[model samples]
Target: MVIAIGFEGSANKIGIGIIRDGEVLANVRKTYITPPGSGFLPKETAEHHRNQVLGLIREALDVSKIYPNEIDVVCYTKGPGMAPPLLAVAIVARTIAQLWNKPILGVNHCIGHIEMGRLITGAQNPTVLYVSGGNTQVIAYSNKRYRIFGETIDIAIGNCLDRFARVIKISNDPSPGYNIEQLAKKGKKYYTLPYAVKGMDVSFSGILSEIGRKALPQKATKKRKLDQEDVNELPSHEDLCYSLQETIFAMLVEITERAMAHCGSNEVLIVGGVGCNERLQEMMGIMCEERGAKLFATDERFCIDNGIMIAHAGYEMFRTGTRMKWNDATITQRFRTDEVEINWEVGKV
Candidate 1:
């Protein structure tokens, strides 16, 4: 039985998890919440991770009832994330591995999400819909790599939603997306927004720009303050939120279905931070039902970024004889999913 300790701080959340075999023994995370109308800065987020990561790691070890010497390997997310935050976590991970004298593995953030989703859902070779603040893509495993079948041309869907939330100054306590989803539930009208899909890819910048024009006053763009009367002059916030969710989620579902048909897969696995949105899951479920396919998703626990995923995927890599030398444990800011060689999946029918 392999025991792995994983660290993840690729973005605003800092997580420490311990896993035994395929089951998670402990998974803990702490997020840095910025005030309303502001987004998390990389420097500040990295500092937050540095400050809280050690405590989180200790807490995870205590919760799992495992000794540091019992850990077989250490894993950390290496890429496709904010540089500062990734570096902060990578430094900690390398230090721990050196101190414990354990093998260290660097994992791709995107592939970690995919592997964890498959492990949790028991979905065998399903088309993957990975949506997060930094990424949005429809992927399928082919030729020993997760190939991108569809992706966003501009900003990711989560970024679009978060920026829109900033326009209205929503709280970032739990999450901007979650707050938008709750507000969307109160919407009675559906305002039309721009929908852009070319072939299998989708675009959200245009949709965001169009929504801003309708939702904000002409002068509100320069200064993000709006009086109650000014707010009434524009479309209802709930309506805008509702319409945004419906429009973008429809695009996501359409692309995912296209990938399913192309790959001849009857199962769809959703992962990443935005995958926790109930509306997205509901839309994907409806689409899968129409096509006689299955939909697999996890709750917020695994849906959002966590260290367990890094541990799980890293363990798979370790089992396949994949290891990163101490000097080669550098992080990549633009690591593509297909760049990693997935040796573990070889010879599987």
Candidate 2:
């Protein structure tokens, strides 16, 4: 019977979601899409969140058929995202909490994804592969915390894909990464790219640099301006996209498998924005099938950053007597997944 309202504007997306018990009543979001060849700036993304958050909240509330007073708690992403955007969401969340006189909980963005994935997929004690525009980590619950087994040493996997899409001038309507995924399906050639994996951690900046030098030469990028017809001498964007996905996803799967083996866990849960990628899921499924394990994932509705995740995670904490004081209701840009205190028992499922 716990009803919670969650606000999430950690990056470019502003999401307001209402959840009752473990089910998502409403999940509404709006993304700020920059033009092709440009990345979303934090300031602009924050402004977009500021402008659209109230409307999204109303939409979520209406869709859920719930009133503000009925909400037992209010939750918002506290960190592991861009500072300005996180702050914008935090402000709105605090305001609404005050107006409704409800308890507030600050949830970790990454853990929200993990908890939401578990709730939807019903995977208990699974090894989590969290991949997103801002984060890439292999995690598992240990010692009452989601410990990171592996992570990206440099830029995130999704950031690398997005930047590559910008270099190729892919459409940013649905998502730059989604556009790359579509083009990758048409790719027949497997152009080799750097596959970086140092122990459990991975690196993508080197691969991005190498691809920029080879498939997208500086001279060609400037002269042809990413025009597929004009850049006939270079490798096709499809090939680059395909190769990038193959290499990076292989690195992710390798680390996830290693973590699963180390933790003695057979269930694998993939969460976060990049978890929406079908190819990644297929690859993970293949690995899981070979290992006689199961893979858990969700569609884009729950995979990407959204408030339902925050609300779900927060409701769990709230149910366990975890509440954020008004003074402690703050946001951070570097909140790691392992930093949060898990109040609930881990073996519930």
Candidate 2: misplaced stretches above 4 Å?
A: 218-230
lDDT by residue (1-349, candidate 1, tens digit) is 8999889999999998899989899999999999999999999999999999989988999999999999999999999899999999999999999999998999999999999999999999899999999999999988888999999999999899999999889999899999999999999899988889999999999999999888777866454777788867888889999999999999999999999999888999999999999989999999999999999999999999999999999999988789787888989999998899888772233
Q: 1-349, model 2: which lDDT tens digit per residue?
A: 8999999999999898899988789999999999999999999999999999878988998899999989999999999899999998999999999999999999999989999999999998999999999999999998889999999999999999999888778888899989999999998999788889999999999999888776665665344565656467788888888888999999999999999999888899999989999999999999999999999999999998998999999999999999777999999889989998898877533
Top candidate by lDDT: 1
lDDT of each: 0.92, 0.91
Q: For all the candidates, what are their Cα RMSDs to the real structure?
A: 1.7, 1.9
lDDT, candidate 1, equals 0.92
> What is the C-alpha local distance difference test score of candidate 2?
0.91
lDDT value, residue 234 of candidate 2: 86
